[model samples]
Target: MRGQEMEHVLEAEGLGKRYGARWALRDCALRLPTGRIAALVGPNGSGKTTLLHLAVGLLRPDAGAVRVFGETPYENTTALADIGFVAQNTPVYRDFTADELVRMGGKVNRRWDATLARTRLAQAGIPPHTPAGKLSGGQRAQVALALALAKRPRLLLLDEPVASLDPLARREFLQSLMGSVAESGTTVLLSSHILADLERSCDFLVVLQAGQVHLTGAVEDIVAAHQQLVGPRHHGEPIDGVATVVRARHTDRQSTLVVRTDGPVTDPAWTVHELSLEDLILAYLAGSDTQSNHEAWGVAA
Candidate 1:
């Protein structure tokens, strides 16, 4: 599946957004292919939410453009209809029952599947007549997700969907989510701070930091392309075969650097180690302050 060619479901080119004096996102770009679960990782205020909004047309870009399935999203009904988005808060009407929300989804979306929504709610143990506001955080999230899934959208966007749930609830929510994705083959772009969950749920990764795209690619390719090296401290000179130095640390006797490269590290002086998703993410986030040209590695737009 990793080598299979798929259509690009979402594409952002030189995207930017600003709030008066501050640019929340700038020169950001990424391509999410169909049929893969992509994790969007960044620290607070790194513009994860901003980027999601831009993709869904909830907010327009101040620069560049974003497209969904090759069409611009803003005010484009076809493009909008292809996407289902659940915000960070997992919003639902307080007075509306779970059944009503499902009905509402049917009314709003041309392709809504009422049976799917009902079945998902039942599977989650959420009663049909329970008012959304009366539901627990986990239940609310489930309902929100059900509503999104019922739309039968080609692309689903979730922003920190499990941030407020407990560990058990988080597990259940993600399980339901992955199950839905598997059955529907929907392309998903999810943003969250839960590294462990992301590591388990996603195959593709996009790391944003300080308003820029630091890394974007298939998780497997990204991991294979980067390595962590620890060795004796010396003048910080560039290493051959290393494409980009993601992060570096130096002590009196030892130096450590996380680097992106296309080939193996042949030097014997440095101890090379593999990096987990969490390790790679943190290393990129730690180097967020540095400036460089944006590059989308494994998957091209």
Candidate 2:
């Protein structure tokens, strides 16, 4: 277990994918450690789904490579068995009852644990006889998660799993997920546009913008390394100790800059404010040229 915890759950090296004339993802790379709930954040069409699909072997990269548990995911039975994926829609057979789905999972996955599946569903208040089509959205999501968890996978990949549910339902679903993570020690890679949800559940963060990895690190470390500075407008004058200006906005008299820095902001000319995870992510996304600032921010491609 200690050796497993030390291994990387996912790694991408020079990964790229294209569709027709557009490159969905390009020169992307990141390493996610095992036993972490890593949040993948990006705007729509920023290649979040593409990256997730590639990681699960649902889509192949046009260039470079992606590995799951140090092995290529494509057509590798061992690698495939180690991963459990819940897509954006939380798809389940509409005609099948909750009990039927559990049975199907047992048949399909080599490591399926039927007892765990039934226990999770019971805890979520899902009746075994209820048809998936007749169940509430939250119930269906719970059923899907139960199926995934039943597989006893080493890595779990969730793509916007709660995007369609109501706030209370979302909270419940995440609670259930966290409970499973605690019990199973599964590494999780979850993608979502909801920053608040990510803040509550995730310890690691990966920010992808325009097919490139803009930032990747521990959530607390990234927040600690960035600051928001408000000061008098000083166009064309560089601020000392500022590693990179992620975003800059100006009013008539003051300039507000979101910056990445190596140390404390001792410059009295600027009032420094600590950033939240949402604030830091938005700053990177708001940059006009995120690729240009990667080196300065110490972000890998």
- Local distance difference test, each candidate: 0.90, 0.90
Q: What are the per-residue Cα lDDT tens digits for candidate 1 across 127-214?
A: 8997999999999999999998888988999999999999999999999999999988999999999999999999999998888998
lDDT of 2 at 27: 97
What's the lDDT of the predicted structure labeled candidate 1?
Answer: 0.90
Weakest lDDT window of 10 consecutive positions for candidate 1: 291-300
Instruction: Give the poorly placed runs of model 2, Cα more than 4 Å off.
Output: 1-6, 289-301
**Quick one: how many clashes does candidate 1 have?**
0
Indicate the TM-score of model 1. 0.92
Each candidate structure's TM-score, on Cα atoms with residue i matched to residue i, is: 0.92, 0.93
The count of residue-pair clashes in candidate 2 stands at 0
Residue clash pairs of candidate 2: none
